[model samples]
Each structure stands twice: as structure tokens, then as C-alpha cells.
Target: MSQTGTIAKKDALAAHPPAPPWAELDASCQLPVLYFLLSGLAWLLVGTLLQFEAGIRLLCPDWCAVCPAMTYGRLVPAAENALVYGFASQMGLGIGLWLLVRLGRTPLVASGLIAAGNVLWNLALTVGILAILLGDGTGHAGLEMPAYSQWMLLAAYMFVGIWGVQTWAHHTSGPYYASQWFLLGAMFWFPWLLTTAQLVVVTFPGRGVLPAITGAWFAGGIQHLWLTPLALAAIYYFIPVITGRPLRNYHLAVVAFWSLALFGGWSGPARLIGGPVPAWIVSAGIVATVLLLIPVTIVALNTGPVLGSRLGQVCENQVLRFLAVAVFCFVLVSLGNALNALRFRAAVTHLSLNEWARGFAYFHGFVALTFLGAAYHVVPRLMRRDWPAPRLVSVHFWFTIVGLALVVIPAAVDGLRQGNELNDAAVPAVKIFDQLRSVFGWRVLGLALMSAGNLAFLTNFGWLLIRCWTPGIRSAVALFIDQSGKSVTAR
Candidate 1:
């Protein structure tokens, strides 16, 4: 009860030191996080295959003429929904939740509920995809899923998102990092954006052009507000750790964060520039899209030095290489968006494959790559094992890069050519059609390669899980034999 007694107690506790906080947190999160990751990778493979199928349909219109569900209209929307809702959203949630708990130094709250919600979310997405294939698509860009399915998705998201909010709240007294801010913003922004879009476009079915306007806005918000922020959250957090250097331009990260938050939602209407929507809305979108250059510039400058200093590491580390590619794609996508939003550039790119090329680059090249890098880093920690095969990872990265370049470059270049020719009445329509056929052929190849990459990743993920749980499996078998001379469940 004296000072000497207290000092001796403290010294003993320090020497022993209970398990690290991250170890405890990772143990709590293993079930739900692993479930999310596994489901996400499965969906990634399914989505990529669907996309490849859609590309084939584009090239050969009569490829699947007999099957109504395989029609181009149904297939395209189905593929997009599968990739965005099924793959990207699920992966982002898994990665974001882990980042939230790790950066906040807090235990996961309501992990059981998150696991249940994950099941519901995937179920709802499955229903939505089937609905689209069955010709029940809402005919909206991002809101193609039917009204009933949309509500279910929203309900499921809340179950997971609320816990994220609570985790951040539990650590409110601690200093917040840029990554936490981005993750928090994404968690809050998606539901609001999805709800508003559903209300205007699907639930209420606004008058003619209004639904179009709402759909454009919703799609843009998904890209800029939801997906972009989720990707950046991982980028900001992992780059420094992977490079073994502190984030440079620390002060500017705040500037980048606030700038992105302010500008993202307003940039959606740029898609409707030449449409029936009011001119002011279009102007606002264009202005916001251009202003996005601010954050884009800040991000490049901020992370550029850290990445540059570790060029050798970037080449040596697969995850670092992925992150580096993500940064480059982010800059490219932002600049392309700004330039294409202009009146002249929009005139050429508005109704062409140029837009599709940009979307592919942004979604697959930028966002998906960032999430993949984060997954490579976090999965090992959670599983308590390193990747079983490094060669598979290298194959995945190269396939992704080469495939993306194939898809984006050919489609973009040909799209501009097609646009310019279409504008000039003198150029024959057949000429543009021929060029499109070539690009579609290239896309088919690219999608095939990308799908192969997805399979490689999924296989690696499965292999890692087998390695991680093998020890526990052996322990269980040994313990069962010692206790009861049988490996039967105890009643």
C-alpha cells in the first residue's frame, strides 16, 4: 500500500504487458472481415466475367440472340451493378471498417451485426442483379436496381455503417487522421446520396427530365463522393506505411480533404451538360469538375514526394506498385474529367465511348487498384499469415495493368475519332462503326485478361485462408483425440 509497493507493481505490469491492441482488434474482426473479403472477391470474378460477356455482345450483336436475359441492355446494367454494388462497395466497406478501428485504436463495435448486414447486403445485390436481367431495371444509370432492392440495400448498409460511426465516436478524444476523416465522410455520404437518388428517380418517378437529372447526379456522387473517398482513405493511410516514410505535405492533406468534400457532390451534373437539364445546373457541374483539379493537384504534390523517394521500394513491393498506379490513375481520371467537362471537349466525348473509357479507368484503374493494395496489406495482418504465393500477386498486378491499358487506350483514342467523325456529317457512319468494332474487339481481350487477374487474386486469397486456419484445425483434431478419442462435436 506504500509508494514502493506501487512502483514494484507497475514495473511487473510493464514487463508482462498484455497483448497488443491490434492483435485483440484483429481477432474480434476476423470473421466479419474475412467474410466480406471472400464474398467481395467472388463478386469481383463474377462481375468481370459479366463485363466480358457484355463486351462480346457489343462486338457480336447476335452472340446470344436466343436468351432474352443476355440482351445487351440487360447485360450492361447487370455487369455495372455487380461490379459497383457487389464488388467495389463490399470491398470498400470491409477495408474501411478495418481502417476505422485501426486508426481510431478502438475495438470493433457490433461485429455480429456487421456480419449479418454483410449477408443481407450481398443477398439484396443478388436480387437486384437478377431483377435487372429480368428486365425490371429502373432504366436509371446507377439506380438500375429496382425500388424494393434499393431499400433492402439501404437497410443493410445502415447496420454496418452505424457501427463505423460508433467506432469513430468511441475515439473522439483522440487525434483524427486524414484517413479517418475520409472514411467517416464516405460512411455518411453514401446513404444520403443513395437515398436521395432513390427517392427522386425510383420511388417517386419524377417528371420526364427530372429523373434523368437525378440519375446523372447520383452516378457522379457515387464516383466522386463515395468511391473516390473510400479509395483515398486507403491511399492516404497505406502509402506512408508501405514506403516507410512519413507523409510529406502533411498540412496540405487537410486542404485536399476539404476541397474534395466540398467539390465532389456538385460535380455530378456535368454528365448532363448537353442534355435537357437546365443550363445553370450544367454550368455548376462543369465549374465543380474543373475545381476538382485543386484536390487532384494537392494529392499528387502531397504523396508525390513520399512515393518518389521510395521509387525502388515501389518497384520491389507489389502493393506499393499498385498504390503508385492508383495515384497516377487518380491524377489522370481527374484531369480527364475536368477537360472532358468543357463545352468543346464534351461535344466530342458526350455520346461516345470516351465517357466509358474514363469510367473504366476511374473505377477499375484508380479505385479498384487502391482497394486491392489495401487488401494485400491488411489481409495478411488479419489472417496472421503471409500470402502463400507471391508469383500469383505479380501475375495479378501485370494482368491488371496491361489489361487496363488495353481497354482505356484503344477505347479513348477511337472514341475521340468516332466523336469527331460523327460531328462532321461528311465522314461516313460506317467508318465510325468499323472503328468501334475494332475497339470492342480490343475490349473483349482486355476484359478477358482482367477476369483472369481476378481469378488469380481469388485463388491467392483462398490459399492464404487455408494456411492460416490449418494450425487451428490441427490443434482441434489433437485436442479432440486427447479428450474423447474421437473428433466429434461435444453435445
Candidate 2:
């Protein structure tokens, strides 16, 4: 308690600073993350192909007219389901688990269980997509998988989810990191939302319009609780690391976290603005959605200055570039959602392509981009090799951004036009469909470009894997040369 004793304690602690949390982890701990990432990429490829097929069908209804399995109604939902469950969820789990271990200062226990769970998770998604194409879909938005398939997904999630919970439980340090909170919240919240949706709309079939209400709720929850947190966690971790600065106003992170958790779950109902649901439900949803801006703004403020300081790095570092764009998209989508929640805008955008546009913006533009950036960082660390080709990374980045802009802009513009036309009783439904032909054509083109970008990603990932297994191909360190003109290894 004396001044001399306090000074001595401080000096000792500073001199013997603790080791980095990640240093405790070994290669075995990385296996689960790699498995999840590889599986996610595979699903992403499948989802992109399905999206292209669905887009083409929209543009030319008769392209596969003879095959009921290839019908737009079937293909579109299957594509959406695959992207959500197969690609997004799988990548999220992998990235989240890895971050938790690093931040929590603990090694991941139950690696085998996590791997097995991921296998079941992918298998369930496979079965679910097949069932949708084969006409056994639940017909609920965000819950399109058959009941049997849903159960399989949930069972697999149990194993993986347990690993996250146990990892958090085993943390050996004080003052939890921001990434840890978001990762833990996402891991716990998703299964709860999924199970509740199933029970309400599947097991105990809602009456009349109840199914629609529940479906809207489920869809909203997926974005706000699951996808948003996963993306935010990645952003929080990368921003500080990439910028070489601790977060500003770190204490406010707790406030931001609680605000999102409390408000996000209820925010889904805003999409049901004019539905048969009670007026209060719609009002509650709108308020919650608008309130979400608090947390979004907090995050932006926290990372803005740090990221701004490193603007130059964005061009040089592939990971930083992807992350910068992802953060921008996150803010854009959040504000857009708040604007869309208004009664006037909701009336115009409701049941229109605008919803699809927004969904794609969040999933592909924000969440998927974040995952891709994280992969750029995590893959090199795991494989101990720098990316084989910087050109491939550039190709993937530019194509994805351009493709998303093409898709989102056209979809929103056309959706607003369609909504206005639909409101005009004088406009015939057939005329509306005819007017959308050009928009659908643009969408098809966008989807094609997006698929091409994904292919580049796959190719790069494949090369990295090959090099990881092959001996003496090239040391990741040798990929770069130091100022002295000698080969320098990347750390």
C-alpha cells in the first residue's frame, strides 16, 4: 500500500509482461478453423452457382422451363438457404472459434467434436438443399429447410456450440476482449433463435398469417444476431491489430454490446410493418431497429479514427482493403435498415426486390467480405505461407465489389419502381413483370461476375493448400525481399 511498494509492483509487472494469448495455442488448435473455412468455401461455390442459376431463371423464365427442379421458386430459396446455413454459418463458426481462442487466452478443447459437428452441419445443409429442390421445403423464409434437416443442423450445432461455450468458460484472464463478447453472444444466440422459430412456425404451426410473422422474425434475427455479431467481432479484432492501436474509448464497448443484444432480437418485426400482426409489434420493431443505430454508431466511432490513420495500408494490404470495405458496408447497411424501417419507405420496399437487395448487401457485401478478409489473415498464419498470388487477391476484391454494386443498385432502383407500379391500380401485373425484364438481365450479369470472383478465391485457396502440404515449394518468408535486397520471411 506504500508508494514505494506500489511503484515496485508496477515495475515488476511491466518487466515480466505476460505472453501473448495466441502463443499458447498449437497447430492442432487451428484444425477446426481450417475445416470450417474449407467447408464454408465449398458451400460458397455451390451457393454462387445456385445464385447464377436462379438469376438466369429470373431473366429468362423458360431457360429451364421443362424441369420443375430448376424452377425459380425452388432454385432461389435453395440458393438463399445454402448461402445462409452452408457458407455464412460455417465460416462464422470457424472464424469465431479461432478468435475466441486467441482472445480468451485459452486453447480450444473438443477439437474432434467441433470437426465432427461441422461435418454434420454441412451434411444437414446438403440434405436440406436437396429437399428444397425436390419439393420438401418448409416454405418459410430463413427456415426453408425441411423439419428433418433442421433437426440435423441443430444437432450438429450443439456439438460446435458447446465448444464455444466451453472455451469461454475456460478463459484464464480478466477483462474479456470485445471479440470474445461478440463471438460468445453469436454462438449462444443463433441456436436459440433457430429453435424458437422452428417451434413457433414448424412444430406448432401458426394459424393463418402467423407463419408470415414468425418467418419475418426469424429472418431479421439471422441478420442482426448471428451474421452481424460475427462480422463485428472480426472487425473489432482486425481494426486494432491492423492499425497497431488499442481501441479508443474501450469501456463503451460493453455499452455497445448490450445495446445490440437487447435491441437486435426484437428488431426483426420491423419487416412486418404492414402485416396482420398487432400494431404494437410493428411499432416495437421499428423502435428497436432505430435504436440499433446507437451501437452501429458506437462501433463506427471506435474504429473510424484508427482505420483513418492507416488509410495508406488499405491499398497495400489485401486484408486491410477488404476489412475497410466491409466496415463501410456494415455502416451503410445499418443506416439503410433504419431508413427502410420508416413507414413510407417500408411501404415502397416491402415485398419488393429491395428486401433482396438489402439482404444481399448485408450477407455478401458486409458479412462475406469480412470473412474473406479474415481468411486472408488467418490462412497465412495457419499455413505459414504468404498468398501465392497477389494478383488473384486483387482480382477477387475488385470483382466482388463491382459485382455487388451492380446487383444492389439495379435491384434497389427497380424494386422501388416496381413497388410504385404495384401501388398504382391502373398498372397491370403483367406490365410490371415486363418492365422488370431489363432489371433481371442486369442482375443475371451481376451474378455472373460474382461467381467469377468466387472462382478466383477458390483457385487461390487451392494453391495455398497445395503449397502448405508441399515441401520446399516456397517459404512464405521468401516471398518478400527486405530493403537490404535479401529474402525476408513474413512473421
Candidate 3:
């Protein structure tokens, strides 16, 4: 994460009055977000390609399990790392740096430290990604980084987090900026959640049942408090940018944030529903999961009118087109999660392909759509370049949407079929092979479409990258000295 701004302009403004100077961020943040979006699209392509998935499951005389590196076990985690770290986390860090400067209306506190932290963060993710492929993961999704790397990462985040919090304190009074709230909230949330989870889940020895509880706590907290907010912050910032309107109910934004904060921790055990975890623990999670509907409904209602009643207006802007799609996906995923929490529906989907379908929908609908929207709005602004290729943009969006549908909807249906066959218990174990066969072709088709979509996404992004850095398209890069505080120049 790095900051870019017009200091000469910021100095001129700050020289004038109480309002702080707001500098636009430099290309550093843009670069990582760009690269990862492309890379994530690449992995998204791979996950859907099913070429490897098929080969892993078959072709060899021996079973794939013997080769852990090539198995779905490794591939799934590795693919997810591509998304969570390669794509989302880096993008989040990059954007968070920008928002810290812009919303704070001041320069970053420790430019060098932020840069160093970013380097370490990327390095940690790199080690973590390879570790996953090598089957050396800590066995946690978000915490896949080995323990040593995580320690370095932990120290690194402290620097960036300090920059964010200091900059936030410097921001002036205004209409409560929802994006700022999310950003500041995230400044507090991520590390706290990480450290808390680390102590209980990793550092402490709570083997067996106790460790399970701690593990659930760690995972759910990360998704809800850390990752969820970054996605929401992006949503809050970009949706308004696209719709060209304030949230329909600004107060509801507060409600949604607090609601998520209050109830987010006690959920997601709906995920491990059939497992051997204690019943009350699972029931508590069920209740919290269901309660999440309140925040979800509020978010949906607030955005719906602005985005919903004026669908044409919303999509008139291509950026909003993606955002509108993400918002709809958010609503769908939230509602689905609520429904999925119910015992009835979960009975048919527990640990099955349907589970994957739901996850895919959430990933595509909420996280991917949000980031795609972010990319569309961000790239042009950062480079000050003419829009790259309208045809490519439209094609990329359509491909992603269609590919998501193919993967999520079909997998969800197949998951139901698979779960139903297995959960019935009356069906002999011998029939499990038949159930697996039914979903095989669908997985293959879905992966192919997904790969096509990713290729389109990467093509458009790569073209923009080439065009932006070209000499002819160059814009004068802006820099300014920090007057009010010690110079924000990297140490």
C-alpha cells in the first residue's frame, strides 16, 4: 500500500483553511490491484478449467491422493489463496492506503513504513501461496501463511494501521462519510481479529474440542470483521461513485455496520453443521447467522431504491453496471446464507457440492463483483488515461457474469443432488460413485466458462496497464511536502 497525491495542490488548499488537503493516490496501489485482478482472474480461470481437476481425479493408474500437490485438496486452497490474498487482500490494502490519504485529507503518516509493510505483506502472501501448493499450509484459509511469515506480517500491519488511524484522526468534520467509517473500522478490525484469533487458535494449546471452537471463532471473525468490511468499504465507496447519489438511508449504513460488528462473530458454524462440534455451539451460530438478516436486509433496502428503482440509470454508467450486479449479488448471497442457516435447507447441503455452490455465489456475487466494480472505476481515474476498450470492458463483464452463473447455479444444483444421495443414509455407500459421476461434466463445463471470463478480464486489464504507462498517455505526476505534520515522505 502506497499513497499518491498532488501536494502542491494539497498545500495550496491546506494553506487556505480548516479543511485538509486531499491528495489522489499514486500508481503503486493501482499496480497491485491491477496485477492481482489479472492474476486472480487467471486462477479463477484455472479453478473453472477443470482440466487439472479432471486429471487429478482420474487418468493416473494410482489415485490422486498419493500426490498431494496435484490433488483437489492443494488446488482448492491454492486457488482460494489466489483470490483471497493475490486478489482481495492486496487490493484491499492498496485501496485502504488511498482511502486513508483521501478521506483523511492528509498525507500518510509513515510512507516508508507503509511501503515496507506492503512489501512484507506481499512477500508473506507469496510464501504463503507457495506453502499452500507445497502442502505446508497452517491449515487455515486466511491464515494460510506459515507461522514465521505471519509474525513478520503482523509487525508489518502495525505500521500501516498506524498510518491509517493517524490519518483518520486528522480528517475534518463533514457529513459522516460511510466509506471513511468502513476504512477506519477496518483499521481497527483486521489486526485485532487476527491477533485475537492467533492467540486462541494458534498460540494457545486448545487441542480437540476447544481448538475447534477457537478455529471456528478465528475463521468466522476474519470473514465477518476483516474481509467482509473491506469488501463493504469498497462497496460503500464505489456504489455511490457509480450511482452518483448518497445512500438512500445514511443512518441505515450505521445500522448495518454496527449490526455486523455486534453479531458477526458468533456465526458460520452453519458451515460445520454436521461435524462433531457441540450442539449448543452450533445452535448459537445458527441464531447469530439468522440474526445477520437484519443487517443484510437493511443494506439491501438502503441500496435497493437508488439502484433498484432506477435500474437503467444505474447501469447507464458501466462502473455502476458492475456495482449494481454486485449489490444484487450481495442481496442474493445474504438471503441465501440466511436460508442456508436453517436446519431444513442445510440438511440437504451439508459439506456437499451445494456448499461449494453457495461459496462460489458469494465469491462471485459479492467479492468478485465488488472488486470488478472497483477496478472499472479506479483504473481510469488513477492513470488519467482515456478509457481503454469499451468492447473489451463489456465482454469482460458479460463473460464473468455468465461464467459465475454456470459455475454457481449448476454446482449448487449438483451439490443438492449429491447431498441428498449421501444424507439419505438409506442409499448404499456403493451409490456414492454414481452421485459423483452426475456432477463431473457440469464441473468441467463450469470451469471452462470461468477460464474464458478470466482471460477476458486479464486482457482488458493488461491492455489498460500497457496504455497507462505509455509515454504518449503520460500525466504529470504530483508530489508535495508535508507542512502541518512531519514530512510524510517515505522514511
Candidate 4:
């Protein structure tokens, strides 16, 4: 070897040893993130199917294959299950593992159980989804998964959730960061929701309207307090780290977390406003939904200024680019939700396309897009590989953003149109069909692009995985890796 080459090697040895191989033992880093992304993808697909079927059922009369099981009515629940159970729950587990590994400053503690939980969670979701596909789906929306399945799911998540909470309890870092609140709270919130939802929706047979109300509460609870907090924690950790900014309003962030959790499980049945429920239950829902504004406002306000100066800087980094868009969408969806909570808005939108759009927007933008953005940061680090292309990342962002727009905007317009038509005594139900066709078409278009984007994301994921997993390939690649670069996927 040349003298200079020998000198370079000595300098390298003197500089620092390679990062530990914990990331490999703990591919659990990707689990929670993947769960959220895939679940979001499942929701996107289900949401698309819902929009398409609604339009086709209205326009095409002979579409009898559009039976209860296959129709938008059934597909909506299937999609929700796919997202909540299949994707989001898995993602949460991954997040917990990743966080535990990092905060513990070691390889994951109890990661094997966590890994087992991840597999079981996906398996339960697969079986449950197939059950839905086979038409065994319970007539309920979020509660379609059978009681046994729910219990199975509860067990699966419990395995990981315990470790996530313990990670925070054991965190040696100075003060628990904002991400800890999100990650740890999510760990606690979800099992409560899953157990609660199962009892109300399935276990307690013959409970009249109470089951429906309880189920709704459970669904809303998980959506708001559990998965969302997990996603938001990821957003807080990544945005500041990537942008090199501190969290704005640290005190407000903590207060909002508590208030939001308190108010979360109360808004769902409000979506069932006109149902034959007690006046008090509906009133409570209405009040809770409105009060959500406080937390939403606080969060949005906090993120707004923290991300303000960095908005320009956000683009300089690929990871923040996806986050910045999702963050903005988060603000929009929260405001839309606030409006929907208004009894007046709910009256017009409760069962309308706008409501569906709003639902998808919140679930997709907040959960799916945010997690996708995070994967861009977390995955590459774990894999110890450079990103394939910055342009591909940008494409992924637009695909998600534009797709979300098509889904939400048109549905909102169609929903308002349908509601206005319903409210008018003179208008026939037939005219509402005409309004739905054009808007539903938009929803389908959005999902198609979103799905394609996900495929692109999957390709990137495969590359990252291979680099981290295949020792032979990694040894040959001379991939640029620094202290920040760590891809631990290999088991």
C-alpha cells in the first residue's frame, strides 16, 4: 500500500471506532414507522374504494355486486381496520422499539417480544382483514374486527407498549423531550382504546344503542390520542433535529398533551348526531369536540413559530420537506375538525363526503404522511446508507400532498352539496347523486397517486433494507456512513 494510504488508515483508527451494531439487532426501529405507513396506505386504498363505490352505486343502478360486504359501507370499516390495526399499530410498535433503543443508549431491551408483537400484530390484522373480505365483518365500522381478533390485537400491542413506557421511565437523558410524551402516552392510550372498543363493540352482547356509542368513543379515542400522538412525537423529534431548532413553547406543548388526551375519546359519537341517542351523550360529544380546539390551537401555534424561520430551511433538508407539508396539513385538518365539531357544521356534514374527506385528511396527513417523512430520516440512519435520490423524496411528498388534496377537497364540496340537498324539502334525493359523481371521482384519483407514491417509497425501503441486511453487499458498496449513519436492519 502507498504510504499515504497507510497513514489514512492509521488516522481512521485513531479517529473513532465504528458505531455499534445495535441498529442491526433492532430493526424494530422500522416497525412502528412501517406500521403507520402501511396502515396509512391501507386507509388510502380503503378510502378510495369507499369514494368509488359511493359514486358508482349512485350513478350505476345495476351494480348489485356492490353488496353490503363489498360496498363502500363495508369497505370503510375494512380500510379503518387496515389502517388502525394493520398499519398504525405496527408503526407504533416500531416507534417504541426505535425510541427504546436510542433512549436506552443500547440495543433494544426486550426487543424480541416487541418483534414478536410486531409479527403477531400484522398476522392478526391480516386474518382480520381477510375476515372482512370474506364478509364476516361485523356491521360496525371501526368495530368490524371480531372480539377474538380484538383481544389478540390487544395482546400483541401490550407486548411492545410496556417496553415503550418503560423506556421513558428509564430514560437517562436530562429532561424527557417532547417526543417522550408523545411516544409514552401513545403506549398507554392505545391498549385502553382497543380494550374499550372491544368490550363495547363486541364482548357485551345485546346492549342496544350503548354499544354503538361506546364503539364510536373508542374509535375516536384511538385516532386522536393514540396513533396521532405517536405521529406528532415523531414530527417534533425530526423537525427540530433536522432543522436544528428548539421546540417553541415547551410549557404549552406539555399542557396541550394532557388536555388533548383528556378530550380525545369523547368526539366520535358526535359524528352520529342524528341517531336516536340520549341528548346528554350527544351534547357531551359536541362539547368535547369543540373543546378540542384548545389543544389543536396550542399545538398548531407552538409548531408554527418553531417551524417559521426554518420553513425556508425546511426545504434544504429532504426529511423536513415531507414533515413541513404534513405539519401544514396537520394544521388544516385540525381546523377542519374543529369546524366539523360545531353542531351546525356536523348537521350538514355528519354523513357527507366532506366528513369522509376530513376523516381521510386527518388520518392520512397526520398519521401516514408524517410517518413517511420520518421513515426517510430514521430508515437511512438505521441502514447506514445514503438516500437513493433527493428528487424521489420530493416526488413522494407531492404525491402524498396532492393525493390528500384530491381526497379531502372534493369530498368536502360533495358533502356540503349533499347536506344542502338533504336539508331542502323541495330537492329530490336523486340530485345528490349527481353532485357525488364528480367529487367521488376526485377521491379515486387521489388514492391512485397515493398508492403509486407508496410503491415508490417501498422501493426506497427495499434499497435501505438490503444495504443494512446483506453483509456481502454492504462490504462491497463502500457506502458513505458517518456517526449519524446507522442502518441496523440485519437480524
Top candidate on lDDT is 1
Q: Considering lDDT, which of the candidate structures 2 and 3 is the better prediction for this target?
A: 2
lDDT of 2 by residue, 234-300 (tens): 9898777766677787778888899999899889889888888899889989999999998988888
Q: Residue 395: error of model 1 in Å?
A: 0.6
Ranking by lDDT: 1, 2, 4, 3
lDDT of 3 by residue, 323-377 (tens): 7788787778777777887888888877787777777777766777777667665
Candidate models: Cα lDDT each: 0.86, 0.83, 0.66, 0.68
Clashing pairs in 1: none
Clashes of 4: 14
Model 1, which residues run further than 4 Å from truth? 1-20, 475-491
Which 10-residue span in candidate 3 carries the lowest summed lDDT?
473-482
- TM-score per candidate, chains pooled: 0.93, 0.90, 0.83, 0.85
**Model 3 superposed RMSD (Cα):** 6.9
RMSD of each: 5.9, 7.9, 6.9, 6.6
Stretches > 4 Å off in candidate 3: 1-67, 140-142, 438-440, 472-491
> Which prediction has more favorable TM-score, 1 or 4?
1
For 1-491, candidate 4 gives per-residue lDDT tens digits of 25335423432343224533444534545554444444544544454454455445544646777466566555656767776666565655565556556544445556566667766776777777667767777776578877767788788877777866665576654577677777777888788877766766787744678777887787778778887787878876776666556778768888778777877768766766878889788878877777877777777776778678886777666677777777777778778877787777778878887777777877777777777777776655554455666567777778878887887887887788898788887998887766677775777677777767766676666665565467755543543444345554323
Residue-by-residue lDDT tens digits, candidate 1, 1-491: 25335423432343224423566777677777877878887888888888889889988888779998999889888989988988889888898888877777678899999999999999999999999999999988878999999999999999989998998787733579888989899999999999999998899978889988888888888998899889998998888766667788889989988888988988999999889889999999999999999989998987899999989999989789999999999999889989999999999998898888999999999999998888887788786567789899999999999999999999999899888999999999987788798898889899899999989999999898777677778778777778855654321
